[model samples]
Target chain A: MPTTDADTTFRFLGCSEIQEILGKQAVDERQLAELLEEVPLDSVYYHTHSYFLRSRFIERTYPNDFAQWVAQQLQDHVLAERLSVVDPFDFQSLEALREELISLIDDHLSGMRTVPRATFGTPFYFNRSRILEVPTGIEVQTLREFRDAISDVDSSAIYFHVFEAHLRLQREENDFSAWFRGSLKLPDLADRMKALNPYLGSLERLRSNMLTMCDEQLAKSGRG
Target chain B: MIRELEQYREVAPKGTIDFLYRLSDLVQDKRFLHISAVRYGGGMVEILRRIVPIMKAMGIEARWEVIAGTQEFTDVTRRITDGLQGREETITNEMYQTYLDVNARNAKVLNLDADLVFVHDPQPAALVDHRKGGKWVWRCHLDAGLPHRPVWSLFRRHVLKYDAAVFSLPGFAQRLPIPKFLLYPSIDPLTEKNRELSRAEITQVLDQFGIARGKPILLQVASFDRFKDQIGTIRAYRMAKKHHHCQLVLAGSGVAHDPEGEAVLAEVQQAAENDPDIHILQLPPEADREINALQRGATIVVQKALKEGFGVSVSEAMWKGKPVIGGTAGGVSTQIVDEATGFIVHSVEGAAFRIRYLLSNPSVMSRMGAMAKEHVRRNFLITRHLSDYFTILKILSSE
Candidate 1:
């Protein structure tokens, strides 16, 4: 294996989420939209992005909590489908994402005669998550080292670099892609890595896809 | 009896134990105090017994203290807890005063000085009034989302004093002014109740209890409480027994603090009515190994509860590679993935139908059982629970 840059090292950061109930409950889409306007930006970030942490499985019907609540509790699959397609990564900030969510609910409500309420005792309680970052002590300088670390690091570490850094922190790119382009100057490799979608599957599948790209890049560079 | 973090390496997810070590390192200097009602019985005590030692091993100063109370005090507190679960218990002004007096007396003797203090359930929640310093958390383990309005009004004042509150599920909490955290209660897979048992050991335990091995054993291991609905379970078993030749084993022991267990047991025994197939064994709380063997020997475990709180026994059975038929109570549905891990039933007839369905299809039973064990391994294990606690403590310590 050859190192492109021995001077710069990418430190793998891991994080665990502790969810806090915001003491706000919404029984109908009207209340949900109102709370979305008033709740903290952290609450907006959590309901949209923390779906991966909750379900470790490969298949998910809805990508975000708001969509899932609407589909299951409100029994409005049409609105859920519209809300599910609103990806957070497209928005530059959570505030923008929050506006999109409120807009979707308000639009859906205007077409309906009666607003649907959730069943008794099953309201969509608003919650916010606190992310606690812990250093994994793994630092890599080469693409091969990064590839090996991805296989060995915790899933939460993968989540931190892929979802949290890219979306929540409003980074220009994910930690892996940014490290690839900046440290190693492999812009092609970095763009290919950025193409790997985080919302398609579980974290394990994401790691595998990232590792495959590294392997392909290494093979072309004669580092295989 | 404490095991090292290294011992759970094969059982836990890769790097999970290491993640806990790193999180614990962040708050190694903080002192954690856990206050509950009793030293014996119940799920909270069982968790503290295992979690405290492991926290100490990780170099955190963790201590557990129980609030000692009189029999009268226990009776009054029981009413309070029952009322919190939406049961129509007659809690007079005198009973409420007794509950506070007991907590006040215990607060004077116990050390309320720690970096983070966890007061378990409503019995010791009022102790937040006497807090000297540090962050106090009211860790409510009940399905308290729809609590009796009067009981919640009396209890909400004490909860408002705490810095934060923790509940087993998001739906299991009330509108508290303080920040509330949702942490799922966990089962220690390394414990005797959940550990792997050999086939010979399982058979011997079954023989001792006169529960024959050939037929599929329909087992429901829960305390004989009305909310647990052992009577409904018996009816379900009887309905299923009409079709399949099976043995129904309802095994449980009374907790010291719960006074209704004996009466519930009597009603359950009467419902069962000397049926040779319905083996009602009221074993003591120390019968962990026997319970483990019974769960392992079971073909399909049933937890048809009308109400529950995280359902540890359901997880324990699932850990032993048994698919469960659970009711849509507090967290039972959360544990059992419908149609994947097990079926969630709404009534006794639904429970019977699922039991019959599982019995008729052998491959689905095995497949669901394997999925159930894997599900528990990934989510309901102690390691995940510990990570949640460390995350809470780290945040509280820094604040």
Candidate 2:
């Protein structure tokens, strides 16, 4: 909670927690060994309970055969999940997370309404032939009605924005050529998107769309 | 902030930034992006606040963005973080859908069209779904070396799609098709943390807090969470009391996402009950000046965390030239050089051993204090971190 940009820099985990994970001062080699014997080696725990001993507490007990078992179990059982496990490792970059997140949209547009399968990898698949059906004007003007029907205090900003952005996107589909001729800043959209530029359908289609929009904008400025 | 950048010149070698100039010669223009939860709080936001503008100054197209989410989004993400950080929590179907549902909403809106997107920590990590034409990298700040399977599994669905990943340590990285980089998180030495405070300023803070500099002060500036080991610090101080008289100051503030903070603070207060010397303070979030005063006023600075992504507070103390006694956990060892900077210890006994050593030998205390400062000056400065980040950018840009 300490602020001023610098203080919040490093993550802090204190000693007693480590002790709790490793168990109270292993006493010694003999004592740690005895404690390990009492821990019922055959017991099964999920990734967190399993890692309690593997990640931080490995040094406390003998870093030998038993440690190897714990390490193996962690790699095979926990890390291999289709869903993420463990704190993000090096391969766990933000860019990758963003790509995977975009896939969820395709999945949502598809028949799949399920949560992302931790074992199934990405649930969404995109193809150029698969154009999402756009909701018509009654829905659009209807959404404006819905937007007006709400109170400010309630948590509907995301819902409202989703509907608005979707309607804006769908409206572009209705007048595809004209929309392509026009610039689309999507201002109500957060700026991060102007940055991420997700795999909406196909890269070539988007590029053509951008080129056409550029030409149209240039025509207004007498530079087409 | 330029003045803040200038302070790094105080310690860095002369004419050392030639690599940057050389790298710029080899670099093509690439947009730099950072995404995480809560743009105003936490380590990543703090880093980006100072760094992004400077990145712009250096001619990189850099901007910081937070993945917008509702309270439900944050609440689920917090649980995922706890689960991924190895806490045993039940991740139900509702929680999982909530996470995806939230990410989908963000994907629909977040502008992620950078050449290189750096996602900080678990939350908003799914924003990569919105990724357009960028080589995304997940810059994981938490201790994911070992995480709960259910949550990680949930996250991994998106993790493998990245171009690469970056971790705080080699030990904390996961194997994937994409490459990963190991970078240590660092502090801006010129900030209120490492910035040179006038004696009067330090004394004024000390007087304000009623922390007598005349008496020995053992201070820890961290969050009020169990992971920080505030309870254990009190116990060590009590144990060390057999030979010396000292005060223990567990000064911290509560983070909004951490539900356990208040509970841990309660436990710490319970432990420090009879001991009047133990000051269990829960300050506001922006309590840097107070933290600086507390550390500057301290005879020994202790970062008694049980698990750590890295104890920047230790580095903060090191910047101030105070002897630090820390648990050899997480990235704490990365800072504490063990009997050199201070002591990379393991237990209350070990902490007590080093704390008692410093309290007893004024010269040892002073020497170690100097060494700690130099250690931070060498490794944990913001400039060093800037160079590390550019190295990643450099590597990615080339690829």
Clashes of each: 0, 54
lDDT of 2 by residue, B103-207 (tens): 788878777788788888878777776678868988888778678877777788788878877777644655555655556788875566556778999899877
Give the candidate number with the greatest lDDT: 1
lDDT for A14 in candidate 1 is: 85
Would you list the clashing residue pairs of candidate 1?
Answer: none
Compared with the true structure, the alpha-carbon lDDT of candidate 2 equals 0.57
- Runs off by more than 4 Å, candidate 1: A1-6, A28-34, A70-82, A102-117, B1-3, B88-101, B234-247, B254-278
**Which runs of model 2 end up more than 4 angstroms from their true locations?**
A1-224, B1-4, B11-13, B16-28, B254-260
lDDT for each residue of candidate 1 in A1-224, tens digit (9 for 90 to 100): 11123587888878888989888889998999999999999998788877687666433578888987887667889999999999776787888889999999999999999998876325788889999988777788888998898888888888888888876777777888888888889999989888777877768788888888989999999996
Q: Write the per-residue lDDT of candidate 2 for residues A96-166, one digit (tens) a residue.
A: 43344234333332543432231311111100010111111111111122222211111111111222122
